[model samples]
Target chain A: LEGCAPCGELAQRLAFLAEVDRLKSVLRASLLCDGSRRENSAEHSWHLALYALVMAPHARPAVEIGRVIRMLLIHDLVEIDTGDVPIHAQNGAAHHGTAQLQAEAEAAERIFGLLPAPQGVELRALWAEFEANETPDAVFAKSLDRAQPVMQNIASGGGTWAEYRVTYAQLVERVGLRIERGAPTLWHWLSESAQVYFTARTGG
Target chain B: LEGCAPCGELAQRLAFLAEVDRLKSVLRASLLCDGSRRENSAEHSWHLALYALVMAPHARPAVEIGRVIRMLLIHDLVEIDTGDVPIHAQNGAAHHGTAQLQAEAEAAERIFGLLPAPQGVELRALWAEFEANETPDAVFAKSLDRAQPVMQNIASGGGTWAEYRVTYAQLVERVGLRIERGAPTLWHWLSESAQVYFTARTGG
Candidate 1:
């Protein structure tokens, strides 16, 4: 831990890395695209970041790709402590509980604060931006975040949707609308494809 | 795939995302710190990018961190096609061969080329930069990349190194030098700790 400073920056960074490794254990409700097992927050965040990078052109043409990537990568680090609350479980009144919001905000500070000062500050800001979902970058990142589980559900033949008894109406209202707002083209393709999947599965 | 496009950028980007998901199946020699299973290239790249962001202060202060993170994220993506080559296997004369390098370069092109034009060009440039390892950003990224496996090996009770018959001398020569070159303090700690580990195991 000794490096020219009393509390080494390297030590702080290593602590942060070790702490975030716990994120790999926090399982999400969605399955991996392969359906081998439930996906973890670490892998989910990684996929979202890659999605942001590859799909940068889809995010409002003026969006900063770097900011979107950063937002995607850090969006779920708070879940390292709060754990993932599956969207299907958060219908209407359940989604807006003040207690859940307060806990996640505190978790964000404690988790991101493990890094050295400047790095911690930067990441917390990015996390906050994504939480707000007001910026184009945040909206785009959220779009991918919402779309990914739907893609996994469809890929795995109704993996989460079937397991949770999630209705097509809920999927459309919760996930599809956000995708449309952020990346209209992606929403169009995804919504149509997802509808076909639900229809085939449910005989709607 | 249909949308208003000066080009079909969104479709191309989505295709690239689906293509890169194959990286999740492309396993590497390093085990997760938990020793559950071999880590995939996607998660490894994600960890390295997060490492670069959190540990940037530990790199030579002059390093451009944004570039280092980008390099870390895309560095092993070529493995999506070429497959991972364990470090222990690349000893002395076996390390350098025209065929291996040529195959990887081709793999890089085909994988990165999956993105839309401008993004693909940028990523290809980033992947090439990491391969060259001359820039400060590349060196920092390479340092993290090398150190990660060592940390995992140590954490998992000599996992891959023990499995592959990797000697202390080989680890020092191949990994230690790079760590020393990029982040001397980490090299000092890791080399000392790793020497103790090898000595205990081999009585050398």
Candidate 2:
């Protein structure tokens, strides 16, 4: 068992495969608002990760695009444990503030544990860094994660936020965390757009 | 807008991606029960669809493997609305089976609604067939979906089931529906296995 790095890697890989199989059990996890055309979480990751690649150029220069990509890719994994807390319900008074965070922390431990010692440690560390939001990369990552949803919700007629009556100002303020901590330019755009968004009638 | 097939196809594509994202999310979903190695839902769907393809020779002769693959691909979308109703918690009293079913129905409608137009309708229909368990293809899809978890839970020392005291007999009996309703041969193996499982660990 000492330095069973290769064995750990094999085990982790096998374990990953098993989880992958299980995940297929529930692909297009739909919300309560719209019916039938619900998107699966898997699609969400791929699409967002791609978005990170495509939109990186438009991102604030100082922020690390790679880190933001990573953050967006894995941000929603916690939903697996906590279930996809609908966008509409995110700001509810349920006080689940850190509950999802805690759940993801635990899940990350289990998932990353399967990898070989070195890879597991590294991956887990990356996840933790993103979670901590202390580093510039983490800040950038968090901002992008929020940004993707903003675009998506808007495209879908403000998807869940509209359903939930979330004001544009509130969303910008909420998402402004990225700028306050890291990307000021992106924040500026978001802030201005949010004012307009709030001022406009509920079009969707 | 009425019989738009493209809408269903677009929804189908989105569902595929979303499911994978869900798996990645699940890998880090639960702290208490999740294993160390995480698997993205996308990986899960790809693998299961592959499973359906590889195991096609093993399925009942008459069942439509293509339809089964579709079922396996999208079965888990409901988790987005209901969250992953862990196997342990599924049988509990609060589920209010009827309400849960209704809620899932509504959520499915919303999630799938994002697709273009015609594509959405087809995907919705496929999802419905899987849920209803009326067709031969759906039966096998349902069967494979149910069967994948059993082996994993067993290998992982019964995983969440052990924590929840899920009975061997109950799982076996559950498979009977698949056999009688889905693939007869698939059920044949499950039915036999259930007897042994029940005998070894009798009376939960």
Candidate 3:
């Protein structure tokens, strides 16, 4: 299989597929809205791609939605090696320290490297763009990444927020601003919804 | 949330998202290659999107890979209501009977309709195109749809093929031809791999 001509490329792609299948086991802290079980990174990535597709019209400065969807689909493949670092967890963003960033960069190289050279490079660059979150496409992709869990939390009666004790103000400071930067309209609605949920939960 | 201006559109999109989240609970006959548990439709859709991204170069007639990836992401959202009809199940293709097709059509309308009008119409059309499997894009998307589970079965030591007692010939007739039509290179390698797995399993 290894020495075969064209089949060698197919073998490499299959090897990459087999390795990434482990992503189904990398569970995130967020629960499904139905409260069934924690969601895995694979399904979370899928849902975010759907988010990009359905929510594209709302992205600020507009974007090439195809690029946004692709970014969402591959953005989290690194979690297959590094495991999910829940955003609501204590010092979660801070946890992506220099060491953690270095580990993720290595994981991205190895995982995407399993493809033939052209695709491996293309996808690795897309993943890097997502980590940078600077381009309009990447910014919207990043917004959906943050927006999904907030939707889940509100639907699941404060899902991770309840579990991790994430306060409304903290959520606004941490998650809201990021989503607002890319999709202000979404943050507008989500902030209203989040306020309603928190006010009801605390009877304030 | 329902009747308010502007926010009305956002509400509809969020409704659509919340509804489709049920897709994660729709289990498929295919197992994760790791053999940990059965795969769900959401993750399966995700992996197929990844397949489109990685395998686009092999698509005959070439394809707009973004549209192909989008098709893969939403192709199985209908399974949310119709439930997964496993390809290797006895009379599996036959089981996509008039009744099932009607159910899936209705499911697509009700689900996609939950989005704001433009996105809803656009997506519903894409879903129908994938179902029709006529265009070059549709052909390639459908090919990856079939190829993914075969890859899973082979990697998991004849995963579903062993469980369902599917023969190599049946696999060729049922799955291989569709793959070959859109991706000859992929079918060439998959058929060779499938033959090896079946032959070794039977010691023939």
Candidate 4:
């Protein structure tokens, strides 16, 4: 709208690029389930983006890989304003769940709106699709994000394990859900790896 | 050029957004000379963006704030492949500098070129302008990015000081270069701050 009709797209492009860059500054995630040892928002997004690429072959019934890629990329932008809340820690958080989710939902809308209308709508839809987890592609993308780090943790002798003292049961529940939801093979391997490592551990 | 003229600037806009998103992931700075903690690329850019905004009044004469802002925003994209080579690390080990700078220059061209030709050209110009540090806008942008974090670290009790083992002497030299190049007033205050802090300890 700020530029000539022909230049409108260029204007929108510049504005959208600026918006996502701004969003990156706001996105943060904790390596631990607790608020400590947090990684910057950009690192989290990068991890997800890489998940989309490497894990693409493992998606469900198969869909547009590009669309699924888009879904994974925007899925976590909402963490910007709501600041990253550790989902696992919310088990007994009382009323914090609804408020936190609502804050994320609102932040998603505002950050997406930073783009011009059309792009804003497209990205918002991708984000929503990923959150709903009903679509095959979204399910796969979400599972990968949840599962890859679990794989890393197991590989690293339980990443964030010593820091947070994550238990076998708790870790299983967190990592096992992915197998049931998407990428059965990755989930299967992850479950087995966790089993072998958890049992072999000596005195904590 | 990938998109036909009729298709317009859509390709460029999408490309630019995608490129900036990737840059954020690649960035990792020690966040001070002392290497206290890592700062996300996005946060670094945000701080620099803020620097451009607040320091406009003190920018070199005839510098365009908009150009400077754009340059500072994307200046670090080159870091995607190069990673954040700290200033202190560069002091005596300048032998490998050309390859890294060349790689970044190419990365900038490829990333910014994703947009429409004109937009790509505009962005590349801005990126190179900041790197050259010859123009007033480039000099001012570079100076601001360097100077702000030094005082910020000092105020924060050498956030990076103890971590990275940065000395006041190094900060003075780095901060002083900015003053000599673009922002004399800011540099002067910082130099004086270093002197005061050092003298108090010296029993002067």
Candidate 5:
């Protein structure tokens, strides 16, 4: 029971949890496949974790699914502070440029800092790895993070693509290359669907 | 490149992903602590997974944090089929009787079955372990599944407790005991807050 004493560590953990609840309110540009409403960052993270778990076999060099899952779950917590920057919106990457990257790094510090030291450092590392997309696990995680919204857009009949008037070339250049790096199989399957989607849109 | 051929395995995996996207639409009994609206099962699953990550250190016997995270992520996928049955609601457990168990098992089968064989079997086994709540990992996972809503309720100044007219006695018996078994420290701290919350309401 002495160990169970009300402690600052517990309070810090709860504070972090409470702050992240804001993520459920931070909407992404992607729509639900059902076309219900825009998906939020929290559930999108959850879905991407699911993607990692199910799609681990598709990773070229293989990856530790657990590490990939960890990356997916916490990678977007920075969005709670910096808000979502959709990569497809006109100049969305431009918008997620140097200033946004700095803000996201600071947000990661403040948000993960809400936890006790060990846990905060571990999660901060995972976030940084996901951003780097250098390791096999991080690359696979980045693939899922990109793949999910593409699936949603295709399923919802050109969801954000339609709304943003994105072209096939932009979709391939901006999103397809990243997915190809980590998950060529997924990108291959999705590119076929994308080609059909855009071709139909142009009545080609 | 041969492995990147659009194959049946890819289709099956995508089907599973598309089907589970419905999970985001299924709402839960607990409101977001912000009181903006009810949280959906998908986001709740996401949040609980986040909880397992941050609170893994608190589990009494300690548990595999990765296994706990997977359990939390997929535990409520059954709710996509059966919908959420809030425990504090009158007859809630009664509603979760044999028939409901059967329905949930079937839901797990159909949903996880949408993935290729190895992945589906792996995920379905995880879901069953979560339901059994017998393993240390499952017990800690159950602790988080319970702790999250109680935290949400307390944070929102009795979010679900007020909504369901839950009494302290019922809270202690129904929720507190479960959390105590795996996360006694969390229960100790939360019970103190619950005491003050209920005491203030009763003017005791």
Candidate 6:
């Protein structure tokens, strides 16, 4: 609307694209696997979408890769309004869930509504499916969403885990269960490797 | 292999994900619409993927949205090794083509090979399909790729165009033809809107 009138699909798409650039500024608790800095929500969504593509063949029940990827890509648009809440935060997660959900519902409407018709509805639905994490696609997407940060934390030498003072028990219960449910094999491999890092820190 | 052993699909996927984080460091000529800094290839790919989802309906021949999204996401990845070569560079475009191609081919192998089997092959092929720009999906992906920079350049007040000393005729031929071929409606609107900016600077 600033650059030009929203005349049609292209205009609407451009406006949405411009608006979503705000996502780059929204930071998260997870560090980059490289230890460079904290990963923003936009980069997290991008990485998870790429992970969906790479891990699609391994998904149990053979989920729809396209749907999974779309869900992953759009899932965090709500965070644009609500801001990122680290799931591992012991005290924060309890109070944040309902408020975050309420805020995100409004956020979804405002953000996805930036697009033209059909796309707005379609993307809103994709975002909702990802939130529900009900379908096979959403489940696999959620698994990658959960798995990536664990990998990042481990790669960065107990990154967010150390920052949040996370214990192995908390991680296994909070993050590992969803991952195991959605991607058992990855959970198997990841949990074994992650325990090595967690155990070393806890013992030391 | 560096941080952890590449023992299985999960390990391989995690390793490959870490390696591709290097894509974030690979910068391109185009500035963000915000004029903060140049966009990285990873961010560029992510934006184009989002655009593929948003613009799928407008593609003239009706491309496979999944494939188009995949192509767009993987296309610039070869640049992680070869470095971004601006498509519209005044002098460099003519001389750099062959060398850039050879370098990108090697980069594609090294980067995509980091993934697990079948996935490595599949992604490599997707990257190639995007490079060739022969299929409907690839064509549309390329159009979006080309169109994005134009929008950036225009939005940033003749950004790369002013810096590189690009002209109206050069832009029409170099960037517009492919955009027109892939999405004529967008091309029509873009060209008309863009001409105002170019003409203002060109005094035509």
Where does candidate 6 stray beyond 4 Å?
A3-6, A90-95, B1-6, B90-96
Which one wins on TM-score? 3
For model 5, what is the alpha-carbon lDDT of residue B37? 93
Residue B69 displacement (Å), model 1: 1.8
In the range B95-135, model 3's lDDT, one tens digit per residue, is 56899899999999988988888888999999999999999
Q: Which residue pairs show backbone clashes in model 5?
A: none
**Model 2: CA > 4 A from native:** A1-8, A20-36, A60-63, A86-98, A179-197, A202-204, B1-204
Best of the candidates, DockQ: 3
Native-to-model Cα distance after best TM-score fit, residue B76 in candidate 1, in Å? 1.8
lDDT of 6 at A87: 84
Residue B137 local lDDT, model 5:
94
Clashing pairs in 3: none
Model 1 residue B113 CA deviation (Å) reads 2.8
In model 5, what is the error at residue B145, expressed in angstroms?
A: 0.5
For model 6, the local distance difference test gives 0.82
lDDT of each: 0.79, 0.54, 0.88, 0.59, 0.87, 0.82
Name the TM-score of candidate 4: 0.50
Lowest lDDT block of 10, candidate 5 chain B: B1-10
Q: Higher-TM-score candidate among 3 and 4?
A: 3
Tens digits of per-residue lDDT for model 3, A1-204: 345446677889888877888999999999998998999999999999999888877887669888888888889889888998888776446556798899899999999998899889999999999999899898899899999999998888889988877778889888899999999999998999899988988899
How should the candidates be ordered by TM-score, best one leading? Answer: 3, 5, 6, 1, 4, 2
B-chain TM-score for every candidate? 0.92, 0.72, 0.94, 0.81, 0.94, 0.94
True lDDT of residue B181, candidate 3: 88
lDDT by residue (A108-167, candidate 1, tens digit) is 999988777787998999999888888888888888999888878876778888877777
Candidate 1 chain A has its poorest 10 consecutive residues by lDDT at A1-10
Q: What is candidate 6's CA lDDT for residue A65?
A: 88
